[model samples]
Target chain A: MKHLIRKDFLKEGYVFATRAAEIARAAGGHTRPARLASNENPYPPSPKAVKAAADVLPPHANRYPDETNKEFIDALKKRHGDYRFVASVGMDGIIDTVIRTLIADGDQVAVATPTYSYYGLAVQAQGGTTVSVPRKADFSVDPEAFCRDAAGGTKLAFLCTPNNPTGGTTETPETIAAICENYEGILFLDCAYIEFDGTDYRPLMKRYRNLIIGRTMSKAYSLAGLRVGYAFVPEWYEPIYQRAATPPFTLNMVSQAAATAALRDTVHVKKIVSVVQEWRQRFIDECPYPVVPGGANFVMVDVAPP
Target chain B: MSPPRKADDVVTELAQKGGVIVRSCASFPPGLPDHYIRVSIGEPWENEAFIAAITDIYQP
Candidate 1:
């Protein structure tokens, strides 16, 4: 058999999701499917969102979605306090856009491993190298070590709060700010799960001109199927991001409608987060497993051998 | 006292009950012990049902 894999794709093995989907399908004759693994919204979008989409789709169906996706951007700015710098695209396109804008070929992307796999893969796809400073025993990036390692070719540092899989966040603002001050490259803070953590980073966005936050409408918004995500770029890099991005109005029409409606339904978001958080705490209190509690919608629970 | 089937077996059991399901963390490496189960808290009926089934196999 020819080893047809590209050299870069060689390191990509173990598609756990593919395997799990298969098993779940095979096991599906059973009734009642409760899927908690994907960290998705257990509920549907609000009635207003559903109506908004219904209102727009037929009228706008004849046209491609707004190239600027202006409606979504405007809604984001309204919720986020500034739309002048927000960029929305599906994850892959946005990731590519950001890397394309900020990284030169062979630039360094420093991220914590045992972390989200996609960040490293995206960097590699753009001909950039991933400098992984492995997480400490507790599955957290060691601040001092990451600072020490943030030298040479390292032009970007990515951090996910209430980090994926491990389900914990950076403990302090100072440490993150320090990394930005210490490194000259862009600081990409993926707070996709910030809403789940019950913490808002709106204030921190002002601290560093190089900081960019990548967020999604998936986890908390109950709109993953809609595929709307946004990045809050520091004002200075806004032009670079816009130039690298696709047309201005590019979000999926239905998704944009759903997101805008979701933004207005703050009560829904609060009720869902509170319910999930309560469930998370009760599960932790009763179960023998170790639970890392946080503001995110999902909690990563570890069950150890006695 | 007889031990229950593996944690996988218990997850299988919880899923059988309507609107009742819990995650099986044993899928990850260094899998959970013979009886460790990770169940989410749900409405009163669901939680009570989970407790009833789970407590049935506790060794103590």
Candidate 2:
């Protein structure tokens, strides 16, 4: 029975972040734990988004979601220009999908260390090797190191802007452009926290045909529970992604509705981003430890005693 | 200043004693120090509570 499972899965299981409820239970069943582990918005989704989802949910309970995902994609296109889009469960799903689409057994994927752990995990799950290059002491990525690794027969590379765990943009736009020009592999730029930083690197999508930029409704839109993620893919790779990555009806009707409405209601998203940005700065300023300067909704503090 | 505590120990203490959940960067590979922790920004009051808790626990 044990042999039935994938060997890699057995060796390395997925580790999730600690939930608020678990924290409360750990603190002797105290209710209302401050959940700052996962970078979830402390606020709720926009009223319009909630209403849009609720309005469609009861009526569409019997029907499967539209496999085309036209409404959400259309709304996204309206916001993010006309680019081929693929919506998935979350950014994690999209990451897995891209890895599966590109990675064959024994293929290599490049990533910068101290970034999102999922890229390595996903690559490993697909029987591919992750070629990791360590970030600088300040957690910034070196374009030369990244490109060097990606050029070594790697099929794909993942770069998270306003990177998770460290909460900083690992590479600058110029560095990203340099990498895209130098490396032949697919470059997946994860902008999951871009809303917090307000940096629109999407223009690079026009410049680089090998680039894919992923975004999510989870962070600033406060739809983490609904799990809507999308990516602006290159026109050439659109059909490839559609055939290899996207399964029919991946996003539910309610989530599609909520995400569509959330996309349209820029005001709500702006408000959430503003609040998170303010608090993030406050945390940096007041934290007693040496905090890493980041543009995301979280701060990474070096808690080592001086 | 107090001696540095392991990130895992700090995370556990914060959750178990202070009811505040933060991420220990020990799991983040390759160069992140064991004493580093990642804390998400929360509401003002929640942030204040976290500061108070970590300050108390991390004090000399």
lDDT for A15 (candidate 1): 32
Pairing residues by index, what is the TM-score of model 2? 0.96
The DockQ values of the predictions, listed in order, are 0.18, 0.69
DockQ of 1: 0.18
Native-to-model Cα distance after best TM-score fit, residue A135 in candidate 2, in Å: 0.9
Model 2 ranges off by over 4 Å: A19-24
Q: What is the number of residue pairs that collide in model 1?
A: 13
Of the candidates shown, which would achieve the greatest DockQ relative to the real structure? 2
Tens-digit lDDT track of model 2 for A1-306: 998988888775555676434756956855778888888899989999999999998877998889878999999899988778999999988898899889979999988777888898889888999887777777778888888766769889888888888876546788889888998999999989888998777888889988999999999899999999999999988787777765666889999999999999999888888888888887877777778888888999887775
lDDT of 2 by residue, B1-60 (tens): 567778887778788777888888887886777988889988777798788878777654
Best by TM-score: 2
Total backbone collisions for each predicted model: 13, 0
**How closely does chain A match the true chain A in each prediction, as TM-score?**
0.89, 0.96
